[model samples]
Target chain A: MDYCRSGFKPKRSLEIILFTSEEPTRFGISCLGSRLLAGSEALAEALKATVDGQNISFLEAARSAGYARDEDDLSRVFLKNDSYSAFVELHIEQAPILEEEGISIGVVTNIAAPASIKVDFEGNGGHAGGVLMPDRNDAGLAAAELMLAIEKHATESGSLDTVGTVGILELYPGAINSIPSKAHLEIDVRDIEESFRNAVINKIHKAAKSIAKKRKVTLSEFKIINQDPPAHSNGSVIKAVVDASDELNLTYKYMISRAYHDSLFMARIAPMGMIFIPCYKGYSHKPEEYASPQDLENGVKVLALTLAKLSLR
Target chain B: MDYCRSGFKPKRSLEIILFTSEEPTRFGISCLGSRLLAGSEALAEALKATVDGQNISFLEAARSAGYARDEDDLSRVFLKNDSYSAFVELHIEQAPILEEEGISIGVVTNIAAPASIKVDFEGNGGHAGGVLMPDRNDAGLAAAELMLAIEKHATESGSLDTVGTVGILELYPGAINSIPSKAHLEIDVRDIEESFRNAVINKIHKAAKSIAKKRKVTLSEFKIINQDPPAHSNGSVIKAVVDASDELNLTYKYMISRAYHDSLFMARIAPMGMIFIPCYKGYSHKPEEYASPQDLENGVKVLALTLAKLSLR
Candidate 1:
């Protein structure tokens, strides 16, 4: 994993390689992931120099110039029984990390899951003035109570470490003069453990049911959306990374991800690990989000050296 | 004063007189109270017949129609001296009574004051998931508490006759996942006594202030969109109607208004009294709200006869 930085700038000529080990490769179709050109190209060039009689072809480029699925498949060159049967995906640190830390590489393990759930409470809307509290059904109030209970549930379950969140809840006929007749809430729960995730889900349903009963309102639960739990970096891949870093005498630390990245999904399909480069302010997902070119270069060099070792094996 | 409803319907072209007699003229203006058409026509027709005159005209018609203002001219026809004078105003019941009970006329002594207020609470909005109970202010919950307090205030006002109603409440970004940062509510309160009305207002303000402090949020109060006090009917006019009903052998009862009508305002300008005919099923405001034609005729007849007595002066 020994590498050096040229400058904190983006070079247009950087070559990016996407490996699936299949001939006539299509990149995005299976376990979709993005491969930035500079890192991928650097790794591909490094591997080309390390392997004997390696054939490299430049396929139709992506709209934004990454090695995306359907563009190339590495299965053509490597197979289950082939000497070089392993898959390695190289990409730029879309997020800045090592650049600010003045480190050249970052090793990642796991990513948090993304999810959204909807809870609906139906109740009768009537005159607040005429309806006695004991007789009236209020959905908004039910939702409020349910939200507080949910916060308690998550806190009690110690799920805050995994960070379950409630993002949006809405009521109908939201008029100041009308008692809320119906309410809908969206809860966002995410975690690396399936059991912990399911517990949070169960807690939400229980809260919804009890709140509905207490408010004398009808409540229903539905899964609006969810994403798979991100795969972990393979043990062998982590060993290779640590060995390569040791061989290069590089200072390194193992890390887990709080955010999602293409590597999260790729880890499921192969022995995958990511190398992060420091970003000035850790900014991403915005126009102003940026990373230093020198960090990018150092990150690419680590990937290149790591791939060189894998190619040699 | 005796006016005839000939058969069941009175399409009679009656002569209306213009008069300057203090009693008749004062009665005419009082008659013009809140129910301009009913009171003015009643008095105008009666005066015409008394003077045996045709087409009586008042110079203040434009002013009454809101076309002009009779600011300082006090010597005009019915405008007389600038001293305050009062008259007895008689109103035909807009609400049902005799018609539903098989009676022709029902006298009312008072009108209930209707108060409608809009309470809007404003606060800062933030990420619902990021903000915890103690870290943030919640206007929606505060609004709910305020609503409950309003009910409690109305009940504790010590006037069993008092009534308070919250008809509408709305919250900004009223999503289940988001903490409500702002809330708006509409309150309607009414009572026969002014003291009770003031008390209810005071309680509402007090509750709002306390809730704001408790929630660590700011609150602002404004005049009720509609705030008019209850009006008392004229004792003399009530007696006259009762005596006339007895003499004419018309079925009648003494009652108070449960709903507001234009006559509520007229009662304030003059010694006022009302006669109610029944409405079928107590349905008054909806499109299906109706009173039988026979009930209408009987009400008109009683009203016509009552007018005849005061019109002759």
Candidate 2:
């Protein structure tokens, strides 16, 4: 509000669109922003993908979208075409890079995408007391090995940009007195570099196969839930932001974003870039999330200058 | 039914009670038969005890038990108790003991109870992408280690009589893209000797404590979900079964019953004994579950003699 109040305006006419939406997709879910402006092509692509083991269908979205069949409400919801010439997003770094390096601004190189992976481990379930150690094929044990294997493989894989997470582990017939027959694990792997992500994924698959064979359990292939390729920043926007930061004499770094943003979708239609200011200890989506006032002001000034230069284009 | 068709009734007119009920309590709720037979005193004790984390109140039981109440026509249910002088149950040996040893009959010594243990692991949840491998207190990873540790501890433990199973493993905020904030594990530890079960439990607790400390995650002590102490077969009943096995010249072993039976509760009412026959590959509760006719016949004959002797007493 203060920045808007200041009598600072870009060279060309500026339109500041304020949006009131729900929380960020906490990793691609039933969200608001992305789905609204992503356009039909992207929506169709997303609809073709699978989420939480369910196929996302255009018909389903169409059904839900038309939930308010009353004329007045449905008219309000419409998809508009590619409007903006160029887009720039200013956000908190959501990581320690800028603060750790004491940089006032971060010129985002690329935004990484999460690769959802599910590994199904199947073994024979039996009475805990009846199934002896030597004879039993415990699926839970196999799953445990897979979790550790993910940590090992992800860490050892070529790129530090790669990250693997085994978040949801569910045991079928999950009883206190029965040996786990089926273990279902949901893993999320991510990397800005597609090849690096693929490499980490390959290692994970190999480990799962080896562990399952060794433990006498069946391992399912990596089920890709939802995966989008990394979105690279526009060169023009990047150059403008760099020049702006230099003019203001504020330290800036080119950093790849481990997190996703709305600009990823916008990048399809128009050139998109993101300017990031530091947050306290990289704490984001937390109560203690903070950014130094001076650093934020410095980032704002850089962003203003970048907008001024981009408007001229 | 065939065993009853033999028309070899005990001298004191025998009233065989045939019962049909729902499957075993997967997590200790919505089951019948045993609790009804157990007198008010025993039922009171059971109600006070927590089974699979549900409070055993009469109100809750009545509500679930009356699921069939809305039916237009249904058979009325009744609970009759303390009705017999002696109760003897004949079952397949779910364990490999009799089949491995080639014993015709098993003179049951005692039925071991499952020590239902639940380990609650609380760790700080964060975005899997944002949290680094080193900074993360990943509960899922810790749980994986615990699962393997259980397998190691149980297998390496002294007696084969002791069995540990981590059946149900649940990860909190179980999204593919979120770091597991908490992991709740249901552990079932069974042993014929009370001391051995306690020892194994102690070892498990110690291991959890150690793991939690190393991983920087918080570990809570084992919360006993439900525990039914080892039920020793009646001394006179054991002697009678032993004598019956001897008279038939069938090799028998005094075996501990790892599986539960109605007689586990019947022991509180009368002199209770169990006869175990060998099943193929020690498979029970499975479609392939099969007991040899010869072994079952041998077991039936022993059971008949034991009943005859007890009836005479």
Candidate 3:
């Protein structure tokens, strides 16, 4: 109660704004909320009593008295107090787990970090007609041979459980008759296990080295980029979620996040867990992307009930 | 005098037109006599007399005649006579043989036939996230595996000399994230030997079938296009060329044609051989592509002497 009237109490409201850019004007709204709604009255009384003890007779528990509105801006307002804050985020699972099982809420354990790499191979360029087989350095051919090598290595290295994928391969100077002097390719590697991850990288490097030697082409490898390993939800939070789900007679299964979320940041500061409702067809970041209203309501209900228990504690 | 005035009187100069497209125009002219010019008088006289002949006039003797003008076209007109006619054809050589050797003329034994094949690989395209191993028939993956199979079959069919090349590979609805539903590729195979050629085709078919079965993808293979076997030069004409070279005491080498030429038609009518003058840097069919005057004279000298000996007989 005291925390609600404190300055630290989060004020939750929907804010709408319009942003103009070269592409188009976008209308967006941010819905914010405070967790101290129940404690506001108690916090106000405590402040009133403190003013009286200081011998200020004119002090009264006036709700408007505590509210300070900015004289210059109508949108700005403030309350003087202090309180702690917490946040929760909700999203849909990318994989086909909740929908396939007809489950309402999915408890997520961890999110995998996708590692993307861009490898640019540079070689000497000469006339295709003038260069001989024994003396030529053909980067496009090298890139092609490397692509096949990666495929071959991926196939031979392990079972289907851990597969290496070349999701994108774009070649520059891509003319039919021109031998590419420099071939740039972006290779993405993803694996849940560290060994397999290293294996993919090592095998690619091996193939590149051997091919460079065979083709007489010089190659420089650059890592270009990487995202850190994302953390998993706390075991206690996961258990609490499971318990809450059981009490509500809602069935849930633990799953990997398989995507990024704002809650991913929250997991670093405090115990964190995620609830996923099914996304229809798992289409996301597209116009066709949609989630069922019933599913969203079910997920919200799960979140509300879970938070209710956590709040009492 | 009788031969020059009646049956084979020297005719007016003629020009040949090659093309009327946006491409560069090719022109040709045959001089009946030389006035300290680049052409031979004997060769020119022979051409004019036959063109003016009543029975063997240019129009009557033409394999196919268009409008005649006093303009030169490299694509059509060459020195013509009742006994023999020269054809000047301007074309591009797709191969790099002459360029590799720093030679001008390409004496081709045969021209490779272009073949088109329909390779239909039917596989299931589903949510890449939903489908697990043993349930997916990825046509693009199968095609990629089969590509290596093709390279392997061509390499191991006991002849490293055979050249099988892939021209186009297209995946239906190409998407990086989707499992390919179908993959179609067009491959071109070339070889000097017919046996090796047949072996390559047979092995590719075998590899495709085996890979499809192994990968659980259904592949339907059909030869949509095939050309007739490449024809070789006449043995007698080749021998005469060798004899002529020996008589000239010129430094020369007997080389097979690495490209198709217009003389392919002439081989049907009479024993035909080609004397190649070295093209400077083996350039052709472009304004920048050039052949030295010395090389042109060498070829013309060989042709003139050969014709002189044949005309006497």
Candidate 4:
């Protein structure tokens, strides 16, 4: 709106869309809006998705929020192949690489794909003192072993892009004096290369099985939540961004986004790219996350120039 | 009541007292009834103890439960030094020892004392996918390392009686895709030998510090909840139990009670001993926990005989 008010006009038509439910906070699915627009299978999931601890589905919530579209008219949300020349997203780097190198703009070539697994372990719990160490099958210990194994497998994967985290851990009948009878964990693994990410996941599964058997704990459940393929930026979009950065005399670096964005699913219907501005210390999804005003201005200038060049072409 | 109806009578006056809250389910303090009866410092703690998620203190709950006594009259609950000739408790062995050995009776020589500690770790949390492995200061990983360290220290403590358990684990902002920023754990360590138990606790504290420093996570809290000394059974009471078992031609073995009992605190005021009968598979504190009908009868016979003998003396 600021650029348009300044009398800057493009020959090609343009539409500014603000995607919704990109964080998965409501329906446990990221990029809901873009995925639906790109006619992806997530629409089916969204229709059936229910909010945690609630009786309402995502579609019902949308309806309550004034989205008055029937299932038959859902295609209206889909984008045609010729809907736009290209799609681009501007976001914080969510990592420290750009800031540490003193770069003003980042041209993302790839968005890392993510896979999540939920693991549950069951063991015979008893009095903490009564159950001798040799006779005990502690589920908490098994979960701990698996957490470390995940770190080891991802770190030794021989790829800097591969990473894993045990984000949630739970123990049943949690008491200071009673042994843990059950343990549950949620693990996240990601990499730019799907193969590398899958390899790490495989190792984690094997490790979970081996640890359960060795510790005499039961591997009750090992469910995969999602395994998405990495999305690559279109060549033309990349070239336009690089050319625009060079023309604007702004420092820029080509990087892979370890975090996925709306552009990931948007790439399915149209060419897509992403522009990243440096966030303080690369922190994201936290209260202290920050991006300097100067960096944001630089990112906006490059994005504006890139859009103008693409519109002219 | 069943034993009294069996045509058996003791020469001395007998009072059958039932203790309460030995499991620490309500006030987070085990042997609440006996701990107060024996005049331990726990009475003071109990006055300040509040039920989890409730506003009522233990004393208030006691009053609600029809316990008519003010703080000034609290001594009415305490037992005098010469309250009785002896004290004895009969319980099912909460371990597989007696059942596996096919023994009906287990004469307890000691009760393993318990010490509980609460630990909290803090780290820099970010997006699970965005945070690089080298850059992650994950509190969950630090807690995992510490859990394994605790098991290692207790197992290697060179005492069969030494045991430790991490029964409670909690992660802050627990989510499947977020790096854990904080972790909290409650640890239980126990042994018949206080020194051995304390040694393991010391090693755990050291390991926690080292792991925190190595992982760049902060050890925000290391609190000791309780560190009570192990209680030894009385010689005369043990002799009476042993003699009763021998005269009844019952199979018996002298063993230590890994599970603490009300008798642990009762020993402070009077000579104390415990008689254990075999339970099927030694399962306790669960729905599957059981003791055979014949085993219960045998335990009752021994108790009756032991009581008669002690009263006569």
Judging by lDDT, tell me the better candidate of 1 and 3.
1
What's the DockQ of model 4?
A: 0.69
Expressed as tens digits, the lDDT of each residue in B1-313 for candidate 1 is 3333333333423333232221113332322333333233444444333321333334344346563374523222232222112233333343334445767767877776767777877665443433333445667666767766776787778876566655456666654334566777767676778788778988898888888888787886544665667888777677778877788787788877645555565454445667776765443323435666866776666666655555554
Q: TM per model?
A: 0.49, 0.77, 0.58, 0.92
- Residue-level lDDT tens digits of model 1 in A1-313: 1222533232212234453421112321212223221123433433323322233233433313564445343323321222222334433343334544666566766555544677888776543322334445678777767666655665566554344444355666554334567777766555666567668778878778887887799985565454456557766666666666677667666755545455554454446676655554443332445566765665666666666555554
Provide the DockQ value for model 3.
Answer: 0.06
Candidate 2 vs 4: which has more DockQ? 4
Cα lDDT tens digits, model 2, B166-282, are 888888778665678789888888778777777878888889989999989999656875566778888998899999999999999988888777766667667789999888877
TM-score, chain B, model 1, is 0.65
Candidate 2, position A173, lDDT = 75
Give Cα-based local distance difference scores for all models.
Answer: 0.55, 0.74, 0.50, 0.88
What local lDDT does model 3 show for residue B51? 47
lDDT, residue A223, model 2? 81
Error of 4 at B252 (Å): 2.0
**Quick one: ranking by TM-score, best first?**
4, 2, 3, 1
Candidate 3, residues B1-313: lDDT per residue as tens digits?
A: 3333455422322233232212111111211111102223433344343443245554343434553454323223333333243322223333345545655443434533223345778765533322333455667666666655655665565643444444345564443333456777655454446676677787778888887898788886645444324446555545555566567665555554433344433443334566665553433333345555665665665554555444444
- CA displacement after TM-score superposition, residue A302 of candidate 2 (Å): 6.7
Q: What is the two-chain DockQ of model 1? A: 0.09
Two-chain DockQ for each candidate model: 0.09, 0.43, 0.06, 0.69
Best by TM-score: 4
Regarding lDDT, does 1 or 2 come out ahead?
2
